[model samples]
Target chain A: MKNTAIEVLAVKNLKKSFILHNQNSIELPVFDNISFSLKEGECLVLAGPSGTGKSTLLRSIYGNYLTHFGEINIYHNQSWINLVEATPHSILNVRRQTLGYVSQFLRVIPRISTLDLVAEPLLEQGETEVHSINRAKDILQKLAIPETLWDLPPATFSGGEQQRVNIAITFVKEFPILLLDEPTASLDQKNKQAVIDLIINARDKGTAIIGIFHDEYVRNAVGTSIFDIEEAKHAA
Target chain B: MTMSLQNPLLKVENLSHYYGDQIGCENINFDIYNGEVLGVVGESGSGKTTLLKLISGLLCPNAGSVAFDTRIEGLRDIYKMSEPERRLLMRTDWGIVYQNPKDGLRMNVSAGANIGERLMAIGNRNYANIRSDSSDWLEKVEMDLERMDHFPETFSGGMLQRLQIARNLITKPRLVFMDEPTSGLDVSVQARLLDLVRGLVSKLGIACVIVSHDLGVMRLLSHRLMVMKSGKVVEQGLTDQVLDDPQDPYTQLLVSSILPV
Candidate 1:
């Protein structure tokens, strides 16, 4: 049967260029006229050799790259809004429910407990403090974080522990579109499998997933389709 | 395939059950092999729960047979077996993980005692050995061994879920039946617990029949998929094939309805 997938994200005529300072501030073209669409419940993996602006393309789609010249159209609240031209307030609203971005490094709050950090999104969604803390505790337990460390800050935790805390926070709430950047970079093999399972679960929930994965095992396990940045740049 | 050559662990044929005049399920037929994970998916009231209870011998089926091959006895109809024999099978060779933690766990008992109860049921009586093994299982499911003395009521939901899993698997049952194992938690919590279940289920090579309305859980855990509608199976096939290219209209609707992340 033909797939009746709805288009959740569409990018048209996308172009990105960076100013090179060492070479007399040259306007080096990173990519041009890159366009693609992501359907609900579909995973699109960005594949190519390094320096192909794969990560840049993902950030551009997330509206983090402000200087990009293109339309990053995201379907939200019964309409399509261009992230490139969207106001900051609209972008925040869109991100609050529609878009979730997981980068390589976590931006940790200095004094917040790990449980509170993970529960922040649910609190923002108006869940009661008790409910939010209980839910956060559950996620932390699943990630193998001990209960003793939950009330402590994540700043002093190990790399894997911090990454798990970061993952716990990002996935605590379900979003319509998820952007993952090397989500399992610092995880051990066992925990890496945990992350892979989480990604697959997200995709199966009809989340439109666009991610950059360096691990071949993870790429093969969860990816349904691949979007080669080199091909996007060179496609006629 | 080679699976057809070997005897199946459980063969269910034309199983029919009713709740008064209403149909619980009708003419259900399937085979569960050793080391296989079979997922049953449907809307609530589609009789998925009824079918599970029937085959597990908790509810008597109105008609048909459930043939379970036991380690001691050759293939025997589950319904025909004596109560003691069936109870023995359930305690030793089979495990059931309920959707609610309270249903599967002893709330007033300590976490270690809950797991140790299963071990003791199967004839492990050394208190020291039981305590050590319970601690090991606690670590395996990633719960703290320190919580071994705590009551299930004092544990968090996810911890209780993990504790329930450790309790169920402590005896190392050859087959397990899970009903909506992750349904009661948040998205991230469900993902983590599902991950743990997937890893443990595979690492131990246990045959399983899991029932869930959540298609994501089935797709990730089941090797085979059976989609039910209105007390009948609409489709059955390999997990990927049935989920990715559902042939039945009901299956199609179900697959298409999953709201992507």
Candidate 2:
């Protein structure tokens, strides 16, 4: 039943640093020579203490951060693309078809209802509005978001509820690769377990996931292997 | 994503415009594909409207070319076309929705005429058919059937805007340029208009280039975003990537300036 043989993402010799120009051009190195490969049905938990560039690694993989050097090769559209070298259009195409990311905070757009917001990715894939909304409702219900909040914008929701909405948006349509950054950071035990179930379910369905989970309980529940940045950096 | 694989419906390369010494927009380059919504965002005086005008053939660019994939002539520079040819293309294959409905609609005509005029211009001589099509469009835009025969002067700003949309879309244009279509409206009305535009744009499979100062509108409607500053494109990327993780300093400031609700 384990479909873990196919590699979906590979990072090789990746390096990133921030240059503070206004303050005498100080160079802050985040991570260097980071390399890893993720396979289908395998959840790799990024493990590190604070400031260990765990989030940076995830963002690099998602093409949100431009790395100084190296390759982020993602299997997209039946071909492999080095995301570091891919054009903006190709990156966007990968994001739409192959990759999905759930950030720590939701960028709540004004005036769009939570249901529409969650259903948007499906609509972009050309699903009928009714079908997209129905799928959105199913995910929202699974995540325990109240039916009353579906029509309202997520901006007014509580932090946990907003995070759940954010999670629901990404999880509503399964992508080949999923990057989760503190997805359960704001949730309680019950909601945290719900999110854990979702992660395991996606993984079991052959999604390759890289996530940062501060909660050890949730990490153990879903992670197939831990990619510890601090340990890897020291070894390098 | 399949849309990107197709050839771009419109392409702008090194397009620039200058009003005397002031730069309207400089060296702008981008491609808009079928069913894609591309948004240009910047503060006032940042050349968003200028870029929109330059590409839509309202204002010709000084340096570069605006090429469109015309049905008759594939991927021809619009600036090089004969004036009559360009005008015909504008009336038949392209639509421009102005910020003010008054700028786009025939204020002297009824809402039904405003919608039917485009169809008439393209040689739909049957009155019964035109009237039926106009009424259908009014319903699609969620306007009352009774309002179809009323002059636009009697309509409110929202209603007038909706009528202008129906007028532009009646001809079934392949590409549409919308300039702040929901600006200066009530928040509720803006939301409704945004929903309507989003639904129509997808359902009709129109390639749209939208210029707006509001990032929320861009996030809601645009598939890709180009961040302009002082007439130059500082950054361009998928909407979520640009807004959530902005790389350019100007884009960072722009995204951060929004007041969180």
lDDT per residue as tens, model 1, B1-261: 112226778999999998888989999988887767899999999999999998887998999999999987778999899999899888888898898989999998899999899889878889999999999999999897789899999888888888988998988887899988888888777867876776676567688899999987787777788989889988876665567546567786788789985
In terms of docking quality, how is candidate 1 classified?
incorrect
Show where candidate 1 strays beyond 4 Å: A1-236, B1-5
Each candidate's DockQ: 0.02, 0.33
Top DockQ: which candidate number?
Answer: 2
Report model 1's TM-score to 2 decimal places.
0.54
Shift of residue B53 alpha carbon in model 2, Å:
1.3
Q: On residues A205-235, what C-alpha lDDT tens digit does candidate 2 reach at each position?
A: 8999999999999999999999999988887
List candidate 2 segments past 4 Å from native.
A1-4, A19-27, A108-113, A128-134, A148-155, B244-249, B252-261
True contacts kept of 2: 0.19
User: What lDDT score is found at residue A70 in candidate 2?
Assistant: 91
Best by TM-score: 2
Against the native chain B, each candidate's TM-score is 0.96, 0.98
Candidate 2 reaches a DockQ of 0.33
